[model samples]
Target: MEHVAKTRDRITLTGVRVRAHHGVFDFEREAGQEFVIDVSVAVDLAAAASGDDLARTVHYGELAEAISAAVERDPVDLIETVAERVASVALAFPAVEEVEVTVHKPQAPITVPFTDVAVTIVRGRA
Candidate 1:
């Protein structure tokens, strides 16, 4: 079987804010924290653009909701796990050929002052 390249067209959702309890320290998880996420999906836009049908493409609203739900679930020790979970969620959409997920934890428990901590992952269909 021949493999087709994914379309360059990308649909992105940024700054998806959610509060979840994910951390290694007991206090950290007990207090909970805010996580910001960004997601991008690559898919063929010809059908959706030409036909103007919602069924032909992945819905941004639905995608955001899915990401939010995924993050708000059970706690994990690392943002890497969250990123992987989000990538899996994005790949579940039939039209998504490739997905990039970024999970950010701004309020991480660091002794030194820092701006943010994040993990990014890219996944594609086989």
Candidate 2:
């Protein structure tokens, strides 16, 4: 069984679309495709809520751009790596305690028909 992170105030960015080259096949690497990324970051928002200060919380706009850049920055062979990379970025925020990332590959090359394929991972500080 996998461990689930404890509940906390979350900032979710879903359906963030980015085009990238990531796959095991040569064609997949050469011909990039669109990837939809979903990220949920767990952080302490009590200060921000009480103080009404943006500085006390994670900025969703900046975080979304950071996640997108991580996805489009390098060409990896697996979405699992991409998910980990996103999680790492999220965990860098001072207020973030845990992160969950989902990398969606809609144009995967498979013989049979499929809607999508993805990898979801959860990570936190050690």
In the range 1-126, model 1's lDDT, one tens digit per residue, is 999665899999999999999999998689999999999999888999999988999999999999999999999999999999999999999999999999999999888999998989999988
| lDDT (Cα, tens digit) per residue for candidate 2, span 14-114 | 99999999999999899999999999998888899999999999999999999999999889999999999999999998889989999999999888999
Q: Judging by TM-score against the true structure, name the best candidate.
A: 1
Q: What is the TM-score of each candidate against the true structure?
A: 0.95, 0.93
Query: How many residue pairs clash per model?
Result: 0, 0
Report model 2's TM-score to 2 decimal places. Answer: 0.93
Which window of ten consecutive residues has the lowest lDDT sum in model 2? 4-13
The 10-residue segment with the lowest total lDDT in model 1: 4-13
Which candidate has the highest lDDT of all?
A: 1
lDDT, model 2, position 71: 92
Off by over 4 Å in 2: 1-7
